[model samples]
Target: MTEFDRRKFPPPEDEAMLPWYRGIFDCGFISLHPFFVIEGLDPRLNEHGTLVLEGKDRPAGADFIKWMDQLSAEHSKGKELHGRSVDHMAKRFGQMIGWGEMCERLGLEDHCELDAALRTHIKGLRDDLTDPEAADRMVRHCAANRIFLPVEGDIPPLFEAKLAAMFRRAGFTEIIAGDEFGDDECIVPVIGLDNEKPWITRDDFPTYGHLRLMAPDHSMLAWVHWDSFYTAIFATKERAASLDLDTTFEGFWCAEETKTFWLTQRPLPLVQPR
Candidate 1:
């Protein structure tokens, strides 16, 4: 068998232990789903977890060219082009397909290019994690809205361990290991949003959406976020669908309502023995 056959999809144990609604910060619910397998050999994964398909995956690149050719046929007039222009195509592709696809079409398929891209991307994530202003902004947004960021590789191991210690110091009861999901991180369940109420709105957030969290009376929302990257909030599969959140979080979403707020209480809640 090839690389595809050797790697386990969700790994049998994870499939058994992780509940359907227990979503992680990586790969959306795609890994959890039974239908599709993770593309193991795809050369798009970088140090920072960004997937730059250009020059990385031949199949995806070929498909991109085929699509462009089809677009030309559909929009171009017989001898003289009437409908689609280069500028129009550029805008449309940028908006609809994305920059990665454009790169693939333009024959910029250099897998090594991801090195620089990862450096820049990871730096931005690091800034958000370290800078007080950026951290404040992230916490406030997460608090006010039920939004979570998905950061892949920008976190350092020491920082993650420190964050875990902080979580324990701050009074979170359980810190679960996230090894099965392919990362050096721990998961601290914020709240469980059961199907009954089915939501953890901004109001439900304990510390204005910062790192602080509470274990709800029920365990519906398997809330999680990457400790390395402090800017995102993770939702369980069940809650992710309810909130209409993009689980994979291919890129950061800019919130139009950019504002700031404060929190006095501890971010995560303390668990009292039942």
Candidate 2:
């Protein structure tokens, strides 16, 4: 087995500060939407799941959460969508990018604000589905939910090419024409960030750092896990000095605390000693 599968890959350094990027069912997935985590000296901020929006470019993700809540209340019986096998929901919401459901909820039938794009995508799926041998492609592209970023560093012929090839094998297209960490246009991964200095969400969450998680040695890798991607950021004193480097939000990666947030999944805590 591979090292990570065998639990041999070194655990990431900063369990707190690093932006955890993964499926909706990941542990470090808890963060206020629209927040971003940047690290190192890369000419491009492009990565799989790396959000490329400023503040308002996000398509009302909070509204999406509200809609998901509504869907859960009427459809899901208080059970989170983590590992629960629901074919119908997966097909309807997971496939068509929630366009159908959004339409249904808004009473927009099959045509509305952005139904054209949705319909085009859906038609492609139908075409693939009816054709034999298309099911495999369908399954992989439809249900794979795999990582889709070709992270190619411009360092050398060894590390950079190796990682770039690896991600490409996993289905990511390298679009880097220059010295940028170019990859697919962050297809499945979505992003949000905290812009207002005093990120006051008014909920259980007290405060947020550019780097969400931290360690006692300040040596943790500048990234965290969600379910599918790895995200990094700056830090806060509480988050920075407390083992996660002396970098605080006062200078870089500063953001307000998200008040209303929950992981909605089983969190596998990183039980590292301080």
Candidate 3:
């Protein structure tokens, strides 16, 4: 059997953000896509169920639910029950079971008459799910919080090498390249700002900084980032040598920490010859 490599397959167009490079002098800032979770990151953004949903292999949600109910009934008959049965039941449901079903399954207490309280709690959660005002409030609440940038995807080590070349062009000569942070391998540099305002804190120069290079035609290429910020901006302009420049419409979502980037190695139109 052939091995499955998710990186080999192109992701859905909705999440597409490919990047390419010509030379160190010609690089751009990575931008944020609208589909990016501005509110918060979805932790399970890239995962799947063990069972394939096709033909005889298809798993039915109702059948799984009924199976759990049967187990509950069996336990009630004074039969010896496994202490960790609920763990197994939860694992079986995985992604197929809906929210309400989950609540019901967990609410099955052995001796406590807490059914009414559980129902009330579930009702409140469900109401929030449908309430437009509540939805707005949630967004507002997230906005009010002072921390964290949601990571869209990881930037592969190969791509990191390309970024290093761009950083060299931007006069970041002193670099500390290591894998100290485990899977979060990074290449940090000591870039002297002098009179230029620092985008990242001096203490954070080892982990975060921006690199902006200008092309012969006046086109601008920039890798923008700051300490304590979630989003890193990679921006490119048609002409950086000229006073007036046109901005490229495309944006990318790259993370330096994760092992595999969701959108990896797809060719970008910007890398093609004019």
> Which TM-score value belongs to model 1?
0.21
Local distance difference test scores for all models: 0.27, 0.24, 0.28
Q: Would you list the rank order by TM-score, best first? A: 1, 3, 2
lDDT of 3 by residue, 13-63 (tens): 334223332232233234321112212322122221111122343255547
Expressed as tens digits, the lDDT of each residue in 64-172 for candidate 1 is: 7776566545443342322222212222221122223322433333311221232333343234323344334433443343222233322211123323333343345
Per-residue C-alpha lDDT of model 2 across residues 1-274, encoded as one tens digit per residue: 2223101011343332223222111121111111111222121211222222223533575575565556445543443332212222222222122323333433433322222222222232234223333323322342333211211111111112222332233333422111011111112110111212111231222223221212222222222222211232232323323322111111112122211111211222222111
Worst ten in a row by lDDT for model 2: 176-185
Model 3 residue runs over 4 Å out of place are 1-152, 174-187, 190-270
Global CA lDDT computed for model 3: 0.28
- Return the number of clashes found in candidate 3: 10
Per-prediction TM-score:
0.21, 0.18, 0.20
Q: What is the lDDT of residue 46 in candidate 1?
A: 13
Worst lDDT run of 10 residues, candidate 3, spans 43-52
> With candidate 3 superimposed using the best TM-score fit, by how many Å does residue 242's alpha carbon deviate from the native?
13
